[model samples]
Target: MSARTLLVDVHTHLYLPRYASLLRSRASVPMIRSRADGDRLIILDNEPSGGRPVGSQYWDRDQKLAFMDKHGIDISIVSTANPWLDFLSVSEATSMANSLNQDLEEYCSSGPSFSPTLQRLYGMGLLPLVPSISVPTILDEVDHVAQLPHLRGVIMGTRGIGKGLDDDALEPVWSKISDKGLVIFLHPHYGVSSSDVWGEKDNGHVLPLALGFPFETTVATTRMILAGVFDRHPSLKILLAHSGGALPILSSRLASCITHDPVVASRLQHDARWYLGKLYYDAVAYGAEELGFVSSTIGRAGKYGTPTTEAVAGSSHMTFGTDHPFFPPILDAVKQDSKWMSVVENLKAIDGVRDWSEAEKSAVRGQNALKLFGLN
Candidate 1:
């Protein structure tokens, strides 16, 4: 259709066989439980029927390619979805992480032969961030992933090698990530666990997914900013999910807070606003207004400084994504035939941005990610 545009979806997901096996072996919330209908994934502790519908889409390569073809997607930079390796013992996590990485690498590289113009696949591998594991071992996995031929980077949760991402212990990991030129698909897994806040009513998973997930990413990133991770590892490229989880909206507020606080004002290299350039946002917000607001905010980041083009450094930071397989079409036709509504919504968001030039839209559609992930 529009092959010249090189449409790429950077937010798709798949759990490798080994990882699925590990989840199945477990009796926990993040496991795949047997059901009369079929297996279902339960990521949250309390979710019973609220867990994701598990199907071949979770593991089949042909299904992934078919989804891409149906959506007119040229490439998919897939990542393992949430609740990654954080729940295992140090030794168990280490082994599982390596196995999962290898499995993912094999999957991404060894796909069934297809035309290069359609459905070329690349991936971000998982890291073993189980608590108390040595930093060098973590670095080892970082290096290991960087070396994988088809692995573009590592997808990580907010929690670092046990400590949070803000922990000084992660400095080495950051340094290595920067040095390796690996993109960090900085995703959120742990949402706020406040059951009381959900109120006396059962609103189901809506409250946690809608509010808690984004807020978790916002807090984790702000914590990293306060800790001066961006200042130290300025070259570190992090692609934030859910359109950076409200960071675009809160960046100015964060900067305002940083300016007023005596302790916070003296901390680092640049304002909280400036850090937006140092970050990348996935266009998974699913609205023209949301995507435009995200792009405008990232581009607006540097205005707080003295004066320079650096202010608009984040304008091209947006890369298109479809949180696929998770948000499948509910309608019969969309479900049976061509495009998925979820993917169509994201594409419409990109296509509908009134202020964006064709070049800018094209960049967000695929070029930005191709350059960022070294796919070119």
Candidate 2:
């Protein structure tokens, strides 16, 4: 609500043309099928007919700037959207990761001639994490990413090295990533297996995309907690997608389950709830109630009022996001200049939380991401 508050959208995406070209050539689940209307992205096997309509918005920088301008967004921290390089040959993945990252760096630093709206962009890079690659190769990429002038961090999927994030193989990778002081933007791609319930039902992609993605994120992060990735690399920072899925809602129950267990409880330095606070969340939960819950639970859930807790509380841990190009405009815009409904909903969520002051809201909008990524 503050006039001075800079709106920072952390949850927006742009697939580099190089990456899209790879997808176009591929013959797999995450491939893109050309169409008369526009290219359709089929991330899941079930969405065989075609996934969402893929157009210039997914890869074009001009469209990205246009969306930001229309939305009144002050700044954006862009990333490669879901289904990121997960299904490539090890050599192919590694090579492509480096090229895409360099391309992104060029895109982000594409000159400072423009004014605030079109020019306000930063990037999160990627890793070639398909399991067969050596940890050294992954670490090499981490070191490589650190050198990109405009890149803040790397985005990773839940299936770390294809063995899930909890795989012991990821430890060294985690350490190196943390060593660079880079954020690991933990976005979800693999939702719950559809075989259990969704396969039999014709619920469209709603069940898998809406529910399954978040749930997968919840499970993956929880597994990391149990594996003590946080305790090992306490400096490592992970920003979760979709407001941490159900992790914020069920954190205490998870802690209780972990604590009650005679084996797991005895091994941890802190409870399950403590680790949740260590993570950051994007404000893409879609409603004020959900945003308020996420802010209170994760921001103040564990060990509230400490010097450390105070640092992470309020809007400091939550960043705003538009998820543009994915959720296009639907319904008539209330105002001729109004942005997409998906973007407006997120803004409304932040504005609806009356308990937070202008300063708090401002932090969630941009200040947090700036400090977290050292963008300021």
Of the candidates shown, which would achieve the greatest TM-score relative to the real structure? 1
Per-residue lDDT of 244 in model 1: 88
lDDT, residue 99, model 1 = 85
Pairs in clash, predicted candidate 1? none
lDDT for each residue of candidate 2 in 248-353, tens digit (9 for 90 to 100): 8998899899878988987777767778778899999889999888888876555732345434574668988878778776545575565687788888898899
* Runs in model 2 lying further than 4 Å from the true structure: 1-4, 111-119, 304-311, 331-338
RMSD of every prediction: 2.1, 2.7
Point out where model 1 deviates above 4 Å.
Answer: 1-4, 48-50, 112-119, 306-314, 332-335
Q: What is the TM-score of each predicted model, taking all chains together?
A: 0.95, 0.93
Q: Residue 121 of candidate 1: its Cα lDDT?
A: 85
TM match of model 2 to true structure: 0.93
> With candidate 1 superimposed using the best TM-score fit, by how many Å does residue 128's alpha carbon deviate from the native?
0.7
